[model samples]
Target: MFLRRIPSTIFGIITRSRLSRTIMSESPAKRLKTSPRKIGTHNGHFHADEALAVYILRLLPEYQDASLLRSRDPAALEECDIIVDVSGVYDGTKHFDHHQRTFAETFSAEYKTKLSSAGLIYKHFAPALISLRLNQPVSHPSVELLYQKVYKEFIEALDANDNGINAYPADVAPAFNTGGITLPSMVGALNPNWNTPVDQAGEDALFLQASKLMGETFARKLDYYISAWLPARDFVVDAINKRFEHDKDGRILVFASSIPWKDHLFTLEKELGITEEGNKPLYVLYSEGSKPGWRIQCVPVSKDSFESRKPLPDVWRGVRDDALSEVSGIPGGVFVHASGFIGGNKTFDGALEMAKKALVM
Candidate 1:
């Protein structure tokens, strides 16, 4: 049966009441304020630092929908909630610019180079930015770890470039330079070329393009740390903690699963007070990737160093299978790397035994 439609006057009253109630329920911050928040930067050439700085600010709740203003006019920027890179003022609160003569800000005391807009925002807002992006608490260990890692891996280079600080001394030539295609260089390239007509509108479009590029790079790198790198560190930590269970002397560590463990291994060893002479790791036993056996790897003296603390027996280098078994008197022998840094066996027990034997030799 078709019901009669409600009177138009009554429907309007009900609709208005519900709308008013909904508006009242929203918190002041969540409600559409009188004006959108504003972020101000320079009008001309774009750089990775300010582009990234804008991206980080937008990641936070307060500035998600903020308007960006690029202009050198003081009056235009004065209305912005935050001014970056062009304000010539750095109070460590809102305005962040490193170009001023008196500006002497750094992300940390460990770094000598002055900070750029990217480093400035990261230093103060990293915990919140990371927490918001990853949906993790600001105080989470991962957040704290990533806060430092992101700067070291991504933001530091931008800061150095913006500050005109050379990564190496002037005397030493760089091993390789990508013809200045670094992140900062790429962002700067987004700016209109010298031959192009200068227009505020053109520069603004370039700024947006640069911001998108910087934002994507930050996101991809952060995800790698959170998803792949962090999980591997857990395995490394567990292996380091239980090292003695595999070897009575605690000189050999075993990982049940394969992982990227070199960096974590060296770092954890020092943090766990295992850096002493006998306590230091000499070998690592772990499963091989895409294979059916285990590997015995000699721990390197340093992450970058080619020298291993204790290489496999000389007879095992470049040897395999029956020959290796015959030389070492160990069963299930597989190939040993020519460098003597790693060897493998058909079983976990066999690989562990290989490490133990190498330890003595």
Candidate 2:
């Protein structure tokens, strides 16, 4: 059972080497030239921004096997290949900290919320990252579109959350209490509970756990937007472009079949310069597909709003079938929602008639 004692410094190196991966780049030349990259962030009490930032950096080819050195120690940080959230600097190249007084970078002039380490790195790396995932060139249309879409839909929220920006004005209260369901909240819960004991290795392990959670969610969102959301844009755009064919006033849009379009209607309208009060679409008509009829849906005032810009006629609301047709002067009227947000018609002409009348009403 006898064993010889080794120097503590030599033992430290032995353990660290095993803890960090040496995968490096797959190319033999790069593998020989590059050691595993070091990603630096603060130690003790991690938050979502730094955790997600570290995870995102590891997604890049250069940092796939990157070792994380979670420390606030200046010398250790300076030795890191890339530092985030701890160095108090903000250069798109290396340091990506948001704590500096001079740090006021938003994604661009169009956005007002300040960037976090996650947003800053995402802004700089998104196109390249997307290109890698999509197997397309960096200049491809999808990459450019997904770059902005991902930032707006996913990263902006994280940036806002990390920078302490409120999603709504304090004067108004939320309708329901969500408790701690948000990504930031979930990541925060992974931390060693304040009253619980902690160790260096234990903290790093939890940090990686938070990072993997963030990375998986991020990847899934990016994938959904690419696979499901983006493809519908062109169809919606075509429907909008051909609106005049359905109605002379260009207020009613007709789609041959139903598609995921509510958000695209609003987005494409603005992009196509349909800003005037008279020019905006009031109703969208599309076949009900599996069902026997067509739907005439009111365009909401905004994406999440319940209020419509112009709802179906109040008289026709809560009416159905023959009664709806007679009341609205549109035959084959299947039904009109009590809320006046949508209506169904037995034929395309019936839906068109309903839309036209509602536009003027």
Candidate 3:
């Protein structure tokens, strides 16, 4: 959940100055002959998708010095190298517009909804873009994992919104009435109010403002996946491979070090052929390095679910040390939560034993 925003100072005006100097100092023949690439999107109102699309383009080396043209004029769009969201034509390359009536493109066959400019650009460029940013090899498993992870976790929502996909059924009550701030909603808020007296220039300024917001959000999301999330996946995968070393049936997993494993656990289960209920691990044990010893936690049914696939024995609930040890007939017992979701022990072996006893119960 830790996302580091792509600082406005880095991708904003400061880099613009450096880019200008680099272009200006080049030989007169090279500099004067070639026109700077211009990135085009519509003027007036903006959305998170287009703003994010623009930001994605700027991350590449080629478009670093590219001019941003916020215009509806076809003549202006013709001069630009890449026209996004405004142009009404998608060629799967230079022109990426999703607003046309005939457009029916998606990121993959698994998705039914059409892609917006954000998804379009991300689908085409994100793998390389992420690899370049993180300094990881493009072929790295982490890069591809992060690419899909970012889309599923972040960019997919933008595509859905831009395509006018209703998240809730008409009859269903919303879980959150009004307080949630989605990216599209945030971008929409930056538009000039109906009552406000603003010219096209003012609208253009607001468009840039929206891009800054989207840019920071996109950067932070990417940063989190690259720096924090990908490593956690690797840790989880390794734990899955060595599950049997801890127990006979491989139904209890033990981690040498603590890491975020919840998100990757179920997905790894299916991939590792631990699909059936009997084949899967009932609980996870990890060294609680910062605390006394180890933690034994019930495995959740799924990522968004609070329900455990198999919770600890009900007798262990809310019990501590001596009482828990006496009740369970195991030593080095520490404590178990009231909900039976988690328990702790004074040793790794004790924690593993706790999880095993629960499995039999």
Candidate 4:
């Protein structure tokens, strides 16, 4: 089960704000936060609020111009019709208090470094604003109405963009564009599987074409979800099971980038009886250096070690083979390389899936 960490205090603050009251009021403008000038302007700018903001924007047309803010810019709000803040949604305690001041400072510094790379200034900014009405109650009817309007507009835009001349016959001009002509070749390319007819091929062909262009985006997403995120906890549990099955005769190796993840694995091992089994001992290897132990090996991957192996993949396979042979004494163990955000999970899952399929072979 995935547990979500939320700060109750933040929710309490939002619930108690004056903005909440205004949102609950009956006035349409108060509920909608629509300025007279903004009502006529079809163009709207949206600020990226976090991962959730992307989801929200996906559902709203008026908020379609949304892009992640590289840095905190309070002044940027002046040019936008609405602003969204997503910072409050994260688990503050886990990220901040758990690590103490040093952890918090380090996290902030790293965040600033990313911002600087993107040419953004590191300044304090708030998320979830719909214009000047900062921290207003979000539950008001006006807010809801605005949300609906934005959503509707976004949907319409998507439909128009999807169905315009490129999607239809060259003779058919887009509803939004006046004098532009769509080429038959562009339309044909858009409707590659035209033999199936529009009504029948609509959804399937659209997805097929999109997959070709995006390089199996959906398949990769599925692979990551099943492989990486779902398995982290299970990996620990499985290692414990394997340890017990082997009666400490075999070693368990765990990999992770954070202490919390490491601790979680440790706890899981203990819970699963891997700790108490007299047969094998567990050793943890990390940046603090190596400790002598028995059945378990904890190795920390350090920046220096990573830097020392500069030629990377050309020599990585040989180095990995040597390490595995030394540790497991098992030759020809599978070598899996997973990279990118979901790479770890995808690789893990793909391996398992392939193994399952290979049973038939």
For each candidate in the order shown, give its overall lDDT on alpha carbons: 0.79, 0.81, 0.81, 0.28
lDDT of 3 by residue, 217-251 (tens): 88777877766777788788777788888777788
Clash number by candidate, in order: 0, 0, 0, 16
State the displacement of the C-alpha of residue 72, model 4, in Å, after optimal TM-score superposition. 18
Which 10 successive residues of model 4 have the least lDDT summed? 116-125
Error of 2 at 63 (Å): 2.3
lDDT of 2 at 177: 92
Candidate with the larger lDDT of 2 and 4: 2
Off by over 4 Å in 3: 1-35, 134-140, 320-326, 329-334
lDDT of 1 at 18: 43
lDDT, candidate 3, equals: 0.81
Per-residue lDDT over 259-352 for candidate 2, one digit per residue giving the tens place of the 0 to 100 score: 7688788878787888997888888899988888999998899988999989888999999988987888777989999999999999998898
RMSD of each: 9.8, 7.9, 4.9, 19.8
Model 1 vs truth, CA RMSD? 9.8
Model 1 has a clash total of: 0
Q: Which model, 1 or 2, shows the larger TM-score?
A: 1
Give one digit per residue, the lDDT tens place, for model 4 in 276-297. 3323223221111142211112
TM-score of 1: 0.84
